[model samples]
Target: MTDMRNGSVTLLEVAPRDGFQSIDKLIPTAEKIAIVEDLLSAGVSRMELGSFVSPKAIPQMADMKEIAAHFKGREGCRMSVLVPNGKGASLALEAGYPDLVFVVSVSETHNRANVNQSVAQSLDQLRAIVAEAGDGGSRLRVDLATSFDCPFTGDVPLDAVRKVAGEALVIAPAAEFALCDTTGRADPMTVAHRFEAVMREAPDETVWAFHGHDTFGMGVANALYAYSAGVTIIEGAAAGLGGCPFAPGATGNTATEDLQFAFEQGGITTGIDRAKLLDTADRIAALPGGKTASHLRIVPRGRAV
Candidate 1:
């Protein structure tokens, strides 16, 4: 059950869903499929393949069902989709995805802006989802967005984060939980403090995860801090392809290659082929209006593969 990199960190490739959704234009479904397949072939074992939100709201993910059907039985990769609400959850489950990521912001203002639901309403919906999924059926990963800071409101309190996460864990005790830096405004200290504190509140059965953005260029550092705080599952987008709707013109989620390079260098293996990962990233960044910003991609270093 062990491998080379000491406390190995697993990565969840989210470019297909998180990254592509940021681009204003709709990427062809075939291209989306190809990119996802390439990421898997590059040795990414976990991923956010797509989402089941209303196509009217996010035209980019309109073809999620088709994408799911294409890679239904693919081996060596665990893929999931973002489900905004009960309907999205039902649709994703019907499409054959048992791994579902349900997102809620700790900041009420951000929650309303992000999902049009108040924080309390989101918790109620999550309670329903946990009941529907049960203890052993669908795997639910609740993403507490804006855990560190909100786009509409600046800094979020640690107590508020713990409260929301506690409420969610109470609803889905066996489910995985992710603290997300939706605005990319988290410093390493806050990342560490929040994760360390929040982790203390969860049961031993809960799996901790970190989802960070790169808007302030602290994505990699924040992820490392989260990892040091005992989070194993880290989420990133290829070529840094996702941007928050609240922070326009800002960079996207943490880059997959950046994470791979950072973790591998720290003796924490990610199992991603560096060269192939970069090439895949390059191809994705080449898409029309595709936005990307990654340090390892720009600077040549000893780790360049």
Candidate 2:
């Protein structure tokens, strides 16, 4: 069941990391920090600020260390960074981040393309990474990319996802899992069914999150269905800014404003200030190559455009 104790839903803003990483232009570190501050002011308590990856592969995230330094120890916000391996995890821990997300794809082909490793190899590396970060007090989360469908392999078997997730739990018993709709191929029904199955398999204390791309315009629907199936953590990017550089034909994630609007209308509280979030979305849209795919941002409520 969705946690409605305070009539609020947890939304992890991913624009600064996931959204900005896909842009061809380098976003200045100062600008990134300002945008993150604005998001915090708009009631976003959790955010994926950036990734600790090779600068050559993702130059946009070259300044993750600086960004992490800026937000470290800030009150009332939980900062998370994506770590690709043990080395990345070391950097994140050294930077004082309290949470880390490691991504692995269910489809072997997509997994190789995204991380240049087979599923077994990645898990082997993950075991080492988990051991290296052992009892570090930092929270570890696994993002099972291509859990729904893989661009290279087409449909991914639910069993494949379950197997990888099961392995991840064995390696990091305290880790959470975020099922990713990497190519936006998941519909509402599929989202519900898959989430239910995973939930049934996950440990009692395991936390499950949903990461959906909006390639086919069903991101919000899929997220809502996941929520219906006991998922409480949802990821989104402001102005729908993001795409998998490694996944061909993949698109931006669900727009933060769009998801907030949908959840609020459905009587789910997101704790986000709608007006402020829309304003932030507009600001993001004005950046170079800032054009977004969010319906609400393009066609907002009230007033003649």
Candidate 3:
């Protein structure tokens, strides 16, 4: 927990969950495992290992238990599993992940459309989840999705996003909170302004992270804006994987390679091996429809794969 306000940076690799789950073709479990392993080998210290929602809702994350079981106690790296509610949180605890991330959308329309729950309902679920995880000696984080703009409900009011984040923190009291631009509607100015506002209104030093999509092709710009605004932990996918099934035509996340490049070129140190990361991206590219959206793909650099 380095002081993010002190200019330290962290990147949470999100390809295994957010990246693969959006595509029509299901990436094999073995491949998913390999990707996670590869990312770890590349010096990515933290990763969004998997999600705990029902397989019916997101079949790609059905193997969460298996993945969680496999990642338990892997040295040096910390893995986080996403939980949608108390049930998912229980499953995460059962699977033995010490770190958990709970997601709640700020937009009512997006919340109902994504999880079939209202904002209040989702907060209530989060309270239960926090209690459950606390009983199990696990840590929890809350991600406020659609904090910027909502596809279903145009521009999401900043107040609504702030309120949901505050409720989540109150339930867990000390849980970390992240803001996500699910549909990638956040511009640089919007990202800077919103994140600054959240920092000002947050209770204590909130563990703030940014999850930005590349739908409007401004993912990198928004992320850079977030970085400039003092956000450290940035969630992104390898090979630019991930898109919203509900918000059709929305592009994938900011490519991990792209984000890394931005940080490295800007004189920021992430402790991640650029060559290894690019190699992993190439491995994904070799997969059917693994076509990468990152700029590194054109460089023809060699590492592995």
lDDT of 3 at 283: 89
After superposing candidate 1 on the true structure, give the runs of residues whose Cα lies further than 4 Å from its correct spot.
Answer: 1-5, 136-138, 247-250, 300-305
> How do the residues 23-71 of candidate 1 rate in per-residue lDDT, one tens digit apiece?
8988888888888878988999999998888989888888888898998
Q: Which of the two candidates, 2 or 3, achieves a greater TM-score against the reference?
A: 2
Clash-forming residue pairs, model 2: none
TM-score computed on alpha carbons, candidate 1: 0.94
lDDT per model vs. reference:
0.85, 0.87, 0.81
Give the deviation of candidate 1 from the true structure as CA RMSD. 2.6
Candidate 3 whole-model C-alpha lDDT, 0 to 1: 0.81
Q: What are the per-residue Cα lDDT tens digits for candidate 3 across 1-305?
A: 13223344678899888887876677788888998899999889889898988888898888788778788889878788888888887888788886888778998888888888999998888888878877422367788888988888788998987788767766777777788989887898889889899888776566678998888878888887888887878888889888767665578888888888787767777778888999898887777767788766665777532
Candidate of highest lDDT = 2
Task: For candidate 2, give the lDDT.
Answer: 0.87
**Model 3 lDDT-worst window of ten:** 1-10
Rank ordering of all candidates by lDDT, starting from the highest: 2, 1, 3
Identify the runs in model 3 with alpha carbons over 4 angstroms from their true place. 1-7, 135-138, 298-305
Residue 218, candidate 1: C-alpha displacement in angstroms: 1.2
- Which 10 residues in a row give candidate 1 its minimum summed lDDT? 1-10
